[model samples]
Target: MTISPIAYDVQVHEYSIRVAGPDDLDSARAVMLDTVYRDFGTGYVPRWHGDIIDLHSAYVAPVRHALLVAVDERDEVVATGALDSRGPAHPPNPRWLAERYPSGETAQLRRIYVRSEHRRRGLARRMVAALLDFVAADGGYRCVYLHTDPAVPGAEDFWRSQGVAVCDEREESGQRVVHFEIPMPVTSSPVVVM
Candidate 1:
C-alpha cells in the first residue's frame, strides 16, 4: 500500500512515513532529547547525562517497532512517533499496563514531539495521522494508545481532537499520567504512498 503525502500548511511539511533505520537513530534520538529538555525545562537535567542515549538506542534497535519522523523543508526532525507491534505496549510495565490498556492487540505511540517553534502548524497532527494510516495498512492492531502528563497543558485536548479517548489516569513516580487510545480499523486498506 502507498500513502500520498497530505498537504498541510505551506510551511508545514511531512516526509514519507519511512521505517526509521540505523542511520536515522541518531537524528531521532537528538530530536527526542531536545524535546524532553525543552518540555521539562531544568528538571530533565539530572537524568540527561545518564539515561537519554540508552533510551534512544532501545527505540532504534527494536526490530518489531516502527518509528516515523516528520521534518520540515530544512530537514530537521520536527516530530516523531513509534508504533510497537509486539505487545501489550512499549515500556511494558505491569503497572502501566493495568492502569491503562487492558492487554490486547495494541500498538503504542511514543515520543510524539514537535519543536515549540513549530507548534500549531498542524505538523503533530499530520504525523499522528500518518502513523495511524501506516498502522491501518499493516493490519491486526486493535488499538493505538499513548500516555501524556497533564502538566503539559493542551496535550489532552490535542489527543482528543485526534480521536483518542481518555481511558484512565494515575499518578506514578510523581508524574501525572493520562492514557488515551483510538480503536484501529479491522480491515486494511491500501495506503496512497507519496
Candidate 2:
C-alpha cells in the first residue's frame, strides 16, 4: 500500500509546502544536517559548516532567491529546496556557462533534501514539481541544473525518473560529481475566466 505524505500535527494525513519564513530556519537546518550527515557521515561538517551557517543570504531573506520547505506531521520541515539565480550576478561557471547561456536564464537547483522518515512517499516528486512550477510562473528560466552524487544508490535513478538528463559526470577533487539538466516548458498566457 502506498503511504501518503504527512502534514502538520493537526492534519497528519496532509502535507503542505510553502516559501520558508524566518521561524522555519531551525526545522530547515535540521533537515539539511540530517541529509548531509546521512550521506557524508561526520566528515563534511568542517568543510561545509561555514557555508551552511551562511544559508540566509542566499536562501532566507533580503534576497530574491527562493527557498521552499515541506512540513510533515508535527510541523517539521521534512524536505527543503532552493533556487539560486544562475544569471550574470551569480554564475556557477563564467568561462563555460556564459558562452552557453548567452541570452537565457538558468536556475541552479539547490538543497533538495527529504528526511529518511518521509522517503518513498512522493514528497520528493511533489517538491520538484513545486519548484518547477515556481520557475515556470516567474517566466524567467530556460532550464534548471543540479549537481548530485550518482554513486549514492538510488540518487541517479530517482533523478532520471524525473526526466533529468545526464549533462556531465566527472570527478571533482577526490569525489565523483554528476550534473543533470532539465529544460523548462515554455509557459503560456493564463486562461482568462469571464
Candidate 3:
C-alpha cells in the first residue's frame, strides 16, 4: 500500500514528502550526516552512524522499513525520517523498555532531521504522518518507539508534542536521551495537495 505524497507551501516554494527510493540515497545520506556532524559536534561517532552510511540496506531494502524524504521544488532533499523494524535493546536502552516493542511488531522512528534553514514549516510533522500512514497500512506494528537527544534544539519538545515520553535518562556517555512511544492504531492519513 502506498501513501500519497504530502505537499507543503513554505514561503513561496512548495515541498513534497514521500517515501524515498534508491535515487535518494546520496541526498538523504548527506542530509542526515550534515545534521549529525553539525548538531552533534565532537560527539559524533562513526560506529553509531552505520545505518546512515548504508541507507539502502538499513531502510529502502527492508520490507518493513522506510525512509521518507522532504524535497523542495528543485527536488533537493531537505529533510529525512525513517521507520525501522528493530526495537531498542539493552546497554544503550534498558531491557525493560526494549521488551515493550518486539522486533516485528514495533516501528522505531529514527534519523528525523530537517535542514536548519527549512525548519518550522511542518516538514517533520508531515513526514512523520507519512511514516505513520505507512505503519498503519502495513498492519503489523503494535507500537511506535523513538529516542531523541535533548541536546538538539527543539528535539525534546518536538517528540513531546508527537508522542508519550516513557523514559528519560542519561546514557553512559552522559548524554540525555528521551524515549517516546506513539500509541498504536495510528489514524493519521496523508494530506495530499492537488
In terms of lDDT, the best-performing candidate is 3
lDDT against the true structure, per candidate, is 0.60, 0.64, 0.81
- How many collisions per candidate? 7, 3, 0
Among these predictions, the greatest TM-score belongs to 3
Candidate number with the higher lDDT (1 or 2): 2
TM-score of each: 0.69, 0.75, 0.86
RMSD of 1: 5.5
TM-score of 2: 0.75
Best first by lDDT, ranked: 3, 2, 1
RMSD of 2: 7.4
Model 3 CA deviation exceeding 4 Å by range: 1-13, 42-44, 171-174, 187-194
lDDT tens digits by residue: candidate 2, 1-194: 32111111222246778777788887887787877778646534654444355667766652335777888756778888777665322243334544544334776677788888787877777777766765665566677776666766677788787765544435333445566676675674432323
Any runs in candidate 1 off by more than 4 Å, and if so which? Answer: 1-17, 42-63, 86-104, 168-175, 189-194
Best-to-worst TM-score order: 3, 2, 1
Tens digit of per-residue lDDT, candidate 1, span 55-99: 444445553346677666666666666666533333433455644
The candidate, 1 or 3, that scores higher on lDDT is 3
List pairs with backbone clashes in candidate 2: 7-14, 7-72, 7-73
What lDDT tens digits, residue by residue, belong to model 3 across residues 1-194? 44432232233248877678778889999999898889866444776778998999999888778888888989899999998988987767777888887788899999999999999998888877777777876677789999988889899999999999988876534657889998665555554434
